[model samples]
Target: MTPRIGLILFTALLMQCENPVKTPLPGAETIPAQIRQTDCFNGGNALFHAARITEMGNRASGTPGYRRQIDYLKEELAKYGWTCREQGFEKETPQGPVRFVNLRARFGKTPNFLDPVRGLLTCHIDTKQGIDGFTGANDGASGAAAILETARILSGEPARAGNLELVFFDGEESFAEHMDSDDGLYGSRHYASAMQQPLPKWMINLDMVGRQGKKIRIPSMTPQ
Candidate 1:
């Protein structure tokens, strides 16, 4: 099986926690009840962001659309007090060597110390290549919108935000019709290779999560 398929299966297994959808946010107990009730994940806002991102047109790697998407994400993320940085790398593809940029964000405008983050949230922002006028609304923009919403929500909880990292990867879609080891996952692979000590305890990678009426099932043996 491909690496991407294996990663998907692993993520599915990890997502089987009890009451997965309804599970309270980390450190929810410390939050005020009023805030918990009123301030929550906003699906409407997420949908709006998704629509706006999709309207930017094709976001294939190294394209003008991709650069526009990056600028938009950086602008929005800065509004919520998150500091953004680009991790740019070059890798050989089936066509040729292409440069890809992955956006990483952390809480605080300028963090003084290098605190070890416990959790990671990531999604690819690049649309598939070779498809004319393909906006990747559900495939690319949706995941990014989800992360953007999550970032907005997490901004309210400094402790939680400090312990987490958000990454928007590029070049997830292969240049060719079929993905192989060398042709796909350029951003993720580069990020993984460049990771330092004290890796994140958990990671959640979102893809094609904006589809309507999609049902996510949790296994019975999930932990509470």
Candidate 2:
């Protein structure tokens, strides 16, 4: 991956300090300005996808909306010439074993169990279950929208030195109101298990990206 482009893109799309989205963290003063000048990382594009994804109704895992969400993502990514696939699996749930699929888009060969890549950008497409009228506009849709927009932007650029992958996970949220160890992060856990040597050196996971003018909270665990 081109660290300069990827870092700048993610910094613009995800960075948050004490300030709001419009506000810059110290020393990264030129980032937002540079972002505005680029064709990639368009907020409007992300918002458009967010709105469309929201309209699919609640994307609770195992629901028809969730399947439609998958279709939409596959369709959109195919337009950009990226190879797409569904990694389907069945896992036990409170109700029973439910099927889930993770959508992956890549610039190189189809993803293998241990395919090595320079960077992986991902977000959950599944919204929390059991909530009435829960659209997950910010929580579920935002990150996926950002990923879609990122794919569009990156597709137009020249190929990178290493492979790039974009993944939309299907079961990030638990079926229960509150998460239990056995219930959540099904997609990521599966992905991690399948990882091989030379795992992605850089990965960005996005959530709650649609809130207006909200501040970013960089975790203490984040690498400096």
Candidate 3:
């Protein structure tokens, strides 16, 4: 999945908020009108955000660059009326116990707005460890940019935006070269464990997306 694909998917999901049916009926015109009314997702803006993220340098978990990235994301989300909370946790990894924080955003001004949402849009924000000069332009930044743009567009549709959550997961990359049960996905794992009952109906996880010439492949076992 490249950035363009991610943007398309996010736009389509928001369209569904207006129409929940799986299949579109004939002469359905509301979606087009909605698109025209709201600020459309801008590919140029997303790329600019991605570039800004990459400029922060290495974002390996527990690093200064990672902290900067988190702060930047929070600032950007706040401008669009998103209230973000840090889901901080400590995990024992192969290297040692590391502190990781997952940023969760909901569309509102209320601090205690813990409502049951319809969907979750997620992406990993940490770059691979032990790599020299690894900016993770496509892997880490692109997905975040896509989500940020989605949040901006959704801000105008409070009714629809309230039924969704945006998450930027940390420590998604493993300390070792390869991932295993003991490593990787630290933030997401903790979040899933801590979530209350009646979770979001669906979730979309984006990673290594937004690269030009990249193609998205669906698994064979995916339901229709």
Candidate 4:
């Protein structure tokens, strides 16, 4: 169930707590000038879709299927040169603390704890529990795949120097069979606190990337 208006505002308050920003790398640039500019984001979009579907089959966390999903992702991302780290946290709720996971993929080492990252690209990897194993077909995997594919496009470019950061978050699915601030998006909330990533110049969160006729509804009637 989606959060009510009051709950939405309340969660926004929690998430808005001034995340400490990381400094930028010297001579850092946003986009590469040499982009082929020919719908390159499309292939990345496709990869995101495929991964989303595959991951949806499992990934409820603490399950064998979830472990397999994490292993596959770690291996695939390593091929792209990201230093992957699996940081685990436990979230508190009425039931007490529940374990959660987050996967961080860094391009290079940072001067401080959090890299002075140019961009933050993220997608949740966990599927919802009540929906036939949540084949998250578009919920979590597409965004992760998009970031990975984007990394390839950014290879050797100045933008990638301290340029990109990708996170495949676990527990985006809430506990107790549904999502709410108390239960869901736990991985991101934990990561933001633990690793302290720099504020991304741009953040693009993608879901349901492969759905036909996908239409995005914006808040305040403004273009995102």
Candidate 5:
């Protein structure tokens, strides 16, 4: 099984609150020049999309904002010749039963529903509910933006190695003040239950991946 890539986009607020100035990595100049080039990751492009998503306000599950976010993803993916669909499910939440949609996209021929895909990339698009001024700028939007950029680049490439799916999950955040096991990850849980075939061996989960002057801390956790 191929190892999954997980991206965490820490919020700029977190960086600012923690420290205004970021600590520079030691021997940074020893790194390849291409590594720092904007064209490599196109972080500027990702940031633009992130800004647009943040403008939509809170994207809590079943809300208009969340629906709009889904629509935006569909449109963008389609533009890259990727077919997209929404898998809808209802979950019991603190407020009530809420509908969540997992937005999925695939390039090239649609794989059979029962066939196993080789790679799957995922990110949560829903923002936490009831938090004032919570736009999920870094938590949700940044990850989505990074996914968009990745999709754009991959879609334009001449060769792709395997059958791949990009998933943007909703209802990842808890509606209540604090999250318990049952309160969050509704979309992913539903997807896991609903799949009829083997899950992709390689899954890339992205979150909290974009913020200026912030160094990402990569947890030494990868499936063996």
Candidate 6:
């Protein structure tokens, strides 16, 4: 049975690498002049580190840790002149009902339009619970750190006037330990559902950030 499972996993890996989608038109059209001068390959890594400090432990669907994470994001966003707010939603678990919070911030003149909103940067700040001796480090912290640091970098630009929105979603983790239709992506679904105008031309969703050196795998239908 072990050998069979290993073979199946190998096959799946092979299938994934069999075809690489054509690269899409790269973004960052409004990159600031100072960034254009940096020779280092890292576009933004400093700010991401700040976000990792908030999670004392698991940021599961309903917990104090999750609330703290949201507050951290809110504070950071406000420092950048971003108007921030939390949209509340309920998370129902076998244990009980938990109130979830989604932190959304918008920067730019017309948040409702693209002419002002040059792009969107986003990730989840909630940490995952560990059973026994395990606690998430990379899985929960990586993406949040990346986006937070990016927020700092982009907002720091003297010429930073382009439209941008950074959102920290909640309830991304599945109550069942694995994401499925019945248990995950609550925040994103609600945010997307509330949009009365055309969605941003670009949106980045960060999930399962534990693995490093990851290559973004865009869907076949994704614009290239």
Evaluate all candidate structures by whole-model CA lDDT and list the values in order.
0.78, 0.74, 0.80, 0.57, 0.72, 0.56
Candidate with best lDDT: 3
**lDDT for model 5, on a 0 to 1 scale?**
0.72
- Provide TM-scores for the models: 0.80, 0.81, 0.82, 0.66, 0.78, 0.66
Q: Give residue 59's error in model 6 in angstroms.
A: 1.4
Off by over 4 Å in 2: 1-9, 13-38, 108-114, 217-220
| Candidate 1 accuracy as TM-score | 0.80
Per-residue lDDT of candidate 2, residues 106-140 (tens digit): 86344453567788888999988778888998898
Clashes of 5: 8
lDDT of 4 by residue, 1-224 (tens): 12233223222322213552233455522333232332133343344436544743766766666777777677766654556778887778545676777777776433232556655567787776657645665676665555555555444453443455667788777667656657777887877776453465555455555444443333463232
Of 1 and 6, the candidate ahead on lDDT is 1
Clashing pairs in 4: 48-142, 56-135, 56-136
lDDT of 1 at 222: 43
Candidates 3 and 5: which is better by TM-score?
A: 3
Residue 84's lDDT in candidate 1: 91
Clashes of each: 0, 1, 2, 3, 8, 8
Q: Candidate 6's residue-wise lDDT over 30-143, tens digit each?
A: 223332323221323422343344335667767776777777667766665566767888867544676778877776433443233444556776655556533355565666
Please identify which of the two predictions, 2 or 4, would achieve the higher TM-score against the true structure. Answer: 2
lDDT per residue (tens digit) for residues 54-172 in model 5:
88997988889988898888887776667787899888998989888999887755644455677777899999877889999889998898778677766755245236778898888
Question: In candidate 3, what residue range of length 10 has the lowest lDDT sum?
Answer: 28-37
Writing each residue's lDDT as its tens digit, candidate 1 over 41-66 gives 65566677887888889899998999
Winner by lDDT between candidate 6 and candidate 4: 4
